[model samples]
Target chain A: MSLEKQIAISPAGELAAKLNSAQLPVDACYQCKKCSSGCPLTFAMDLLPDQVIRLALLGQEEQVLGAVTPWVCSSCETCTTRCPNGIDIAGVMDWLKEEALRRGYSIPQVQISRFHQSFLETVRLGGGRLSEPLLLGLYSLRSGKTLEKLKSGELKDELLLGWELVRRGRLKPKLPKKLKGAGEIAAFFAKSER
Target chain B: MKVSYYPGCSLEETAIDYAESIAAVAPLLDLELAELEDWNCCGASAAHSINHTLALDLSARNLLIARQAGLDLVVPCALCFNRLKVAEKALPVPQENKGKTQPPVKVWDLLDYLTQPEFLKSLAGKVVRPLAGLKAVCYYGCLAARPPKVTDKEAYENPGNMEALLRALGAEPLDWSYKTDCCGAGLALARPDIIDTLVKRLYDRALAAGAECFVVSCQMCQANLDLPQKRIAKKAGRDYYLPVLYFTELIGLALAHPEVDKWLARHLVDPRPLLKKLGALSAFA
Candidate 1:
């Protein structure tokens, strides 16, 4: 068995690229670990916010891409605001989420990427954003597990939430009757994907 | 003056008092609330935790909906206001990756909309009886002040703007420790155990600092302090209660409406005792 771990990039080169590119201050990360110290959900993460930034700066892209922190970061920005050096760790985490997905890395615990993608797909399909049908679809998909959780025996709970929105006049059934650049924006996201 | 009103999800349900208060005070301020039609949840804690872009998109869509209505938004809920402001900050920033998607709208906070000079001037003249002697502790929870990127224009730790607004309404605003602390928001839903601790910590600090009662701008915060605090205290085996008033409710009382009873009567925690102590509660049978 091989005892050595694979490296993502040579540390020196990665640090140089990060220094030039990342808006967060690499030197200001004071190793105090305040970010990890304050995270409310740290128990759920394999890599802490401070550690992800540290690894990214260290050119450990393989380690970062494989880690669970990026997917779990709520972008609460609690870690960033509490950082003594004012580093935007949450922004870095957001960057990492996009990067990890681009690299085809998956997080098992986060486990809801497909559901979220469905929401975006709904937006793309409408030529703009619409929440009610999109969320109903998302909820129905989620209701599979939610039903099992309901020993309380109320599957209509989800439907009731939707109906409540309707009663308040907050939810609507129709998409924008017409939009000028709807086709253009959808085309833009589609082409950008390529 | 016209303002786009974004009464976040809780307003229609648990925090209806806040909606009532906003409605009561809006006419007095000569402010017109053009409600944003077909608005969705701002995705405060859940969507943000589960999916980042979806959260931003949810908040941004509300903003764009307001923009489509040709009005900038006003939110009475601090969490919704903060989420909208954060989404606004996130939307304009160019992402690094070329092929990745982003949310398609910009967002703004209620404070951001209300603080505009002309709007503030309109609110100034509507003060009828001015809460002369009440010393209010302006409680801005973590949601309203975090993410310095979103709160760049407003000072996060020192949110004296609420104080300034209170002062303008002729009430003295107290500087207190629990001003920006968590009010155990949605934790009351999924994690009631943790809320007992967070709520007590918040109320204790304000009581110690000599605050008459808490004045808040968030429905979630108001719910925790107003209705749920008694249960929280009971869970902790402590007997303590503090009156939490919406900022709009204070302004409403100061204006001396005939309908003040309806508004004050709606509070799960009665504010009449505190208002009478402040010499502002009036002759309403």
Candidate 2:
């Protein structure tokens, strides 16, 4: 029986330093598998939540950034809540996704990334609030899921649901009134970018 | 008691039933809920994923508004509450505003706010119609109770606050697994396959535990569980038309509010038949 764990020597400490600066204790993980065991989306992830942390600790920055696990993370905080070591595992995932985007890495989970962009753009245009219909329209256009839905005949179901929601007053077709501090909110985004 | 209400984005659209019911019951509980003027989104699951500072600033702006209004905050959406609470803690100390201390604004999830002893006593006395025959599983979802250090919940997994409120309204709160389970959160929008899997599991567990319906605190959970059940059922070749309802709507029903039916009608799966069968509909009638 092999009692040794394989080690990879690499200059991946850059990712670790970034995570530390972001206040994530990636080094505190001990592979208890508590996080992986509890993550609802673990089955869909290319690397389990625990494996992502292990990669981060090992300085496997390229692999961690390239993996779809972080994008697939729902940020439900299940792993963070259940971690015995008190690691903010979900927070680490969020950082990984941001790092990937910042570095212009090709995200494997394209639709999820596009959805995030669409969501933020909606908030930005709506003056920090989300308008559901506008968001749905923009997301569909950006993700190209609208064409897919049309092809698969799922568009009908979506349209029906939209009609039902609007009828029930659960959704409004008109644009919402922009908040009074729209300029300040937009300036906040601009300053954060700088 | 008065509090600044932050409905978040969902309440303005998808979770309007929750907004309506909360408004409908506010007078009964003697709680004045003033909408936070010109509030914005809490940055939810997406902002943190894209830019950490963006998420913090979005929530901080709202908190600053509530603080400036001189009122404590009451948030109904669990995701909003979690994000706002995290932002409140993580907002960077502005260099220009150094040495100026702002009073801490108390934020309360609606369930936590209503479960306080004084509020519960008032609620109990105002139950014009108790939910006598209704049976439900209180589904807290993930964000509402998780990372207890942030939310300050006593027990994330087995929190009894929602059940306690259910009991107060004379409904049987069934014990079940998946109370704090993840229902795929924002993934419901981007990845329905994952949501389908998660919601199917929740339905199987809830049905096995004899839950007539699911009572939830988060809008995402209600949307995930309610909107996808039909497709999940078709794919699994099973019948699972379980009603996923906001806990606020259930409280409205228990209070015998005339508009409960209007609220229930917004559900994709018609919950009225089940409510009628359980003798829950007559209260609204």
Candidate 3:
């Protein structure tokens, strides 16, 4: 066999072990497409939910971690709910997101990851609570979508929606109110520094 | 009855109307929502997606505060409710404080707490200005009940809690297929295209059910369903002027709360004209 075929056929088994660490019953998924059927975000996903699990079961760590399916997963829990074998597919998706980050996989769904990073950054900096204006500003800058839109002269779409929200007192453009338990929240962040 | 209330971060701004609507109708049901002082965000989907332990720790901080009050906690946001409950479940007691006699705290979504048997009885009695002709579908976007294991929700698939509550207030709750379906709330900002798709599906389904509006419990659901109407309309070649509302706002309207008008005004697609048409507006308004 050629080197490419040998590598593709080899079963590393580490990815499956990591997934099953939480008693996820990763081995028990019997190719039931119930998860795939119920998943709402599959239209945007490169691999279906069931297909992602199938690859993981086959120890295809590169294919599983690098897939767009995990990043686009809305964490809606539709697959988890329908899984007859009781695999936490949504939870697994979350794990895959975390794992992808840890392994430095080039995320195809870059904006999605940036949005999540913005959320965590907002909570940490705001002393616990997230500030909406700050979140949008951070996400806009971090994702580079704002700059892209600005260059394309297409930023008006988001601006119009934001202005509408502002009219209704929905999106406030102020600093978040600092909460009392900053020390502990900071400590939690420090201890779990990823 | 008194309960600790965690309004969560959204209530502070985007969904302030939901908070006020709940407050507007709280007194009629004799419900005292003692705010959980100095509580923080549950870290929401962001923390959970990246770090599970941090997510649990964030909500655990709030759970600790709730445990101090020794009261059942009521969370107004569906996402917060799920995050807090997940926190309580994961770290039932603070890791350091394990084996100590800490008072257990039961976390409830605001909708769940309001629809409890005792509360429901009081709510039924307080429906003075009934929303007789108002037609809206109860849209329970995911997180309030999902995964079954974390939420422990018996009625995840076809939850009728909101419908039952709306009926007590004399409004017709329309039946729709996507009641418990995902609205792509997690992808609201990151991928507007996907959110528009998911939300448009909901709008189409709700309108096809002969409904005039979307009654939502989650603020994310309300925002997703409400904010994208113009864009969705342009793309679909149809106008969906469906007014998305907080179920509490409808309750406030049915109970004749004065702030109902103010709450209705905050929504992007105004439900006031719909209310006027249905004769569901407060007399003072």
Candidate 4:
């Protein structure tokens, strides 16, 4: 059977509509492969950038969500800039990641997801700014992998670098002074939860 | 020219040197940077990926602050600039502010300010030390000049604004392919292996082009390239010693300010030797 014959048209059309509403024109992508060619992390991704778009256009949401490409994308926007169709491929990748989170799919790249949560928590704690030490500490604890490196002393180089940064006043030991409108910022996050 | 400045989160903490250098060089170029008071984070990569509405609201709050100030906003961090600029375009007008067809305020990247012919002309006469022929490559990274639609830069793919500023500072800007390449940005913390690979490619190309150092505008790029070059070099089994400095820091050095060293000392990879070699340091030093 032809690959086209294998796909269900109804679901594919529905997925395309959903993606269009999110401002990601996956249907506009012509499989030029320019996005994949320009993506720096393609070597590490399970599927190519172009493949992700093609699968989404075909409404293969489970496969697309399960793949590691969306989670690993750094949102560099190189693909979006280089796309001949101007499809905002990077934005589509972001949408895929968001959908994966919403649908409760397990992220293939656990570290990246952990870092994102830790980063947002750090922002919330700082009332907007990032506290470097706090972010690193929380990320280490939350990820659990960094703690393994720490226990095994494999992170010694990172420690030395941290000390050097401290000496030069780059990394402060204290938490950042929270912005005055913490309540308002917290409320915005709370509203978004709904 | 007076503009509302948004230093974002990194500038307040890890990238304080970037903020210091910008302040140090602002007066010489006749630019007055008034930081936006009570400004919150732009949500950066964290919020945008997780919750789109939250990202829009976070950046909208900051833009509203700038709108009320009635001054054009200047964002020094590329990531923050991208977030704010994207928000300005994506957010809908609230019911209270509907039908206000015009954009409330314009967002300016630091390069947008420095690249102006008038600003460059004014800055040229203020150069006490003209970088003394230092060969440097301009690294735009991703956010400041990419996804042409969001940034609306004409030369997003091959931007020459940084090169123009380099020439004004009397440094030789080497033309390279990785100017707008990604440096792994926030992923630097999550995936060092990926950053190692990416930074290695960048360093290899810069070295091949005979660049003594890199001039960057993004705080994330500066952190990734400067802090990890040594480890990346070791991993790649190449002897690389390139120093990455913020473009503003170079301006601070060329201006021959007494406090320039204080700003230089904050880099993980020391940039003084490169500065000294090029004779870019002031006689007073």
Which candidate achieves the best DockQ against the true structure? 3
- Which clashing pairs does model 1 show? none
lDDT at A7, model 1: 40
Candidate 4 scores an iRMS of: 1.2
Regions more than 4 Å wrong, model 3: A1-8, A151-153, B93-103, B282-285
Per-candidate fnat, comma-separated: 0.08, 0.78, 0.88, 0.78
DockQ of each: 0.11, 0.77, 0.82, 0.74
lDDT string for model 4 (B1-285, tens) is 898999887887679899899998898888899999888877888788877878888988898888878788999899899998898788654344455544457888888778789988877888878886799999998898777788878888888988888888888999999898888977888889899988888988998999999999998899999888778878778788898988899888877878888888899888888787766764635
Query: Model 1 interface RMSD, in angstroms?
Result: 6.8
For model 3, how does the per-residue alpha-carbon lDDT over A28-88 read when each residue is reduced to its tens digit?
A: 8899799999988889989999988887888888888899998889888889988998888
Positional deviation of B285 in candidate 3, in angstroms? 4.3
Single out the weakest 10-residue window by summed lDDT for candidate 4 chain A.
Answer: A1-10
Question: Mind giving the per-residue lDDT tens digits that candidate 2 earns over B1-285?
Answer: 889999999888988888888899888787899999999888788898988888888898888888778678999999899988897777653343348766567888888988888877877887877888778898998877777888888888888888889998999999987798888869877888888888899999998988889999888888888877778998899899799988888888888888899889988888999888878787565
Q: What is the per-residue lDDT of model 3 for residues B1-285, given as tens digits with 9 covering 90 to 100?
A: 899999989898889898889887887788899999899889899998988779889988888889888899998888898898777777746433556665567888889888988877878898888888788899998899987788889999999999999899888998888999999887888888898788888888888999999899999998888888888898889877899999898888888877788888888888888888777774855
Full-model lDDT, candidate 3: 0.86
Please, what is the TM-score per model? 0.66, 0.95, 0.95, 0.94
Report, for every candidate in turn, its global Cα lDDT versus the true structure.
Answer: 0.65, 0.85, 0.86, 0.85
DockQ measured for candidate 4: 0.74
Interface RMSD of every predicted model, in angstroms: 6.8, 1.1, 0.9, 1.2
| Candidate 1 lDDT for residue B228 | 63
Q: What is the DockQ of candidate 2?
A: 0.77
Please state the Cα-based DockQ of model 1 relative to the true two-chain complex. 0.11
The residue pairs in collision within model 2 are none
Error of 2 at B152 (Å): 1.8
Angstrom error of the Cα, residue B283, model 4: value is 2.9
Model 4 error, position A159 (Å) = 1.7
